[model samples]
Target: MSKTAEEVKRIEEPYVCSKKERLGHALGVLGHDGANTMRGYTMPFLTDILQLPAPFLMILTTLGQVLDAFTDISMGVIADRTRSKWGRFRPWVLRAGPLFCIFMALSFLKLPIGVVGMCAFAGFMYIATGSFAFTAVDIPFWSLPAAMTSNTKERSEIIGGTTTCSSMIIGLTGIVVPLALSAFGKFEWTSYFFTAAIIAVFAICMYLTSFKLVREHVVPDDSVKFSLKLGLKSIFTNQPLLCVQIANVFFLLSIILRSYLNYYYCTYNLGNLSLAAVLSTINTIGMVSGALLFTIFSKRIGKRNCLFISALVCLTSNLVLYFSGWSNVILLFTCAAITTVAIGFGYVCVNAMIADTIEYGEWKTGQRNEAMITSTRCFVTKCVGALASVLVLSSISLTGFVPQATEQTLGALNGFHIMYSLLPAITMVLAATPMFFYKLTEKRHAEIMVELAARKEKKENK
Candidate 1:
């Protein structure tokens, strides 16, 4: 017979472990699933490889992202209902990881087709197919942390450590890719695609290595029917989930805008592509350091409080960036670092908070749907990403950004500045405002867990 919830909780109590083991596991998961590959490669590909007009490229990419929302949510529902000896999340990751890598590599292949036609085809196929695979892997992977341990403080530590490692990978990509392309003495599309393939292989191997090490404590209920309508109903009815979804839309919108504009600011405003690495390095350092520190502080301050503080810091950093003059690279770097740190703290806590909401949902509806919960998060993220892409590109088009211009017109430069600074700053501030209403606390979570354990025990004994 399966162990009782009380017995399982007791056995899982010594949640702390070696840093290297935890970091490896975290990096393995993040490298394979953190959506880092596209961030590192796609924008550059659109700009440098296909040579499609930026506005058109952005519009197409946004549409592709929007299309993925349905796929991600559907996969989540399927995963929650799936039963496998390999575990619900792990098996999907194993099945989907290589496929995702293959698709990612193929997305970069430069077809001899016309730029617009090729880009449209590539964007549609890659985003649609890759998103399905990604959702399959991602839903379960994220849900595993909650199942990994029930200890609140331990969960924070795990999340913080894992997030730090993940941020490091993201940081490395931001810094190294530009440098690597530069070192190759040519920035051909083929070279970038080849490099991504190599890195993706390594990432997939790392993720696979953890398959044997990490264990899932929760099992899927195969008897439960999976229904898209029911899944939507469950998600819409949950208050905390609703709050998180709304907040995430704004949060992701801000981040996506910042990412889309980063290239523009570096290439045109900063006047050096290499500066991307320097900015990325500083931002990444801030993120890593902040995650580490929050891991330590979360043990004392609690996740909600940490999230609130993080929002304040992020808001302040954005204000600094918006107000600071363009020539002030040092100030910009400092603000970027601060902003990264804030985002780091917020990201870890927010994820942990969502995990807690799974228990809340169970308490309310007598169901555990980690995949559904996670997919909701992904849905918000993708929807926001789509909106951001459209906004950024539309703004560029409105400002008369010329494709292949030797230098940007003053109007184009102004558009870039407003996009890089004003748009993100406004959205971030709005995102943080909703967190004040987030009502879950550690004390409440503890009470919920205790009740859940008793309820499960009574049901099992019968």
Candidate 2:
């Protein structure tokens, strides 16, 4: 337990995961992100396809996010304490696949074309799935990694696999969804419905394989009882956790806002909506590459340093994009690709760092509330995601942009650039600032793991 380098080096071997666990974990994350990719269309789908007002769409999405903020932790607390033969978190993860598939498909269904009926029906379905049903799966799903293994490299592999898989799915979604819609000859309910069915089936298969074969190595103590106040308060006491949450909010805000604006950037700025697919594919490739590269980068430079580097890359790309993207498509794609890659790197670092925080929390707080800890992860994502939605709504209203319009005014175009560039530039910097306060180094985390192992061993022997 010394701070000696020799001790740190000798403490753990190079943990080689089996092919089954590695592949299964990757598929599980892919399924989770794919379902979200399908449901996450609430703002874009309603505005683009249904021609709903941004304000109207905003209310539904914001409400869902707000409700989800509260319920996410509640679900985490419940999952953390549950005693089941299948295990605490796995049961929830196992059931989420089919539920989301059904709900996501229904949300995309071409209900009778009346405005009021469509709004109520789709809104309910969207909220039901996004806020309630999906969180049931998401909180526990992310929680599983911390419980699965205490080895830092092994955790990175799990998080890295998830990040890479999710990025690939998102990249493919950008390419796939548009192509699917093109086949229908126009954007309509049919496009979404058919596409959702395919995504749903594949996602279900991914989840089934993950839980059925792959294993979780760390399980929560059955002795820890669930408490609403204790679960809520734990978030504040964990300094490293708080630091991670703050950084995550800003970083994810930048990511989501850029994604929303990319549609407009490609359609109006590039003058061809279909080019969105091309640019998306580029970003996707870049992101997957970045995630892979950062896997090595974090090992060399440390996770916090890698994250700061990611922020710098994103800021530079957005700054370039804002000043010059309107004039050239090549610059736009190149910078966009760079931005996605940076974002992908950041995602991997943060995910792995969060897993470390779970151990840090248990070491310091004497409790490892994986479900609650990971719940904050989801809550920050949704919370910032809500703000990004608002940023879009305000941009739409401020720009005097009309939904389903064939074209937009110059002012509206500038607004898109501001969001796509200036705003994210600011958030990217903010994301990095908090990483400075994150004090959990790799050596420190390894020491914590060794001590925690000794503590557990002492407990079992008694």
Give the winner by TM-score.
Answer: 2
Where does candidate 2 clash, by residue pair? none
lDDT: worst 10-residue window of model 1: 31-40
Superposed model 2: Cα runs more than 4 Å off: 1-17, 223-230
Q: lDDT tens digits, residues 1-462, model 1?
A: 244445545633466445554554586666564345444356656665666686666766666676676787777787777777877777776777666766676677778778667867677655744466666676767766665655655666676667777777777777777676666632477777777777778767877776656666555455666666656666777777777666677766766677667766787778776888897788678878888777777769987778778777877778778777568898988888888887877777777777778878877767777788888887776667667666766766687665545487888777777777677677766777777787767667666676777787798799
Give the Å error, residue 322, model 2: 0.4
Positional deviation of 125 in candidate 2, in angstroms?
1.5
Query: Model 2: per-residue lDDT, tens digit, 1-462?
Result: 765545655665456557777777788977778877767665666777777666677788789887987899888888888777777777877887678777887777766668888788878887888788888888888877666675667767888888898899988887877667667844577778888888888888888888886676666676765666656566777788888889999999998887776666666656666887897799789889999999788879998999899999999998998888577878888888898889888888888888778877778667778889899999889888788888887888888777656688888888888888889999999998887788988877878777876788799999
Q: Candidate 1: list runs displaced more than 4 Å.
A: 1-24, 33-35, 38-40, 53-59, 185-187, 221-233, 404-406
lDDT of 2 at 287: 87
lDDT of each: 0.70, 0.80
Model 2 clash tally, residue pairs: 0
Distance from true position, residue 278, model 1, in Å? Answer: 0.5
Per-model tally of clashing residue pairs = 0, 0
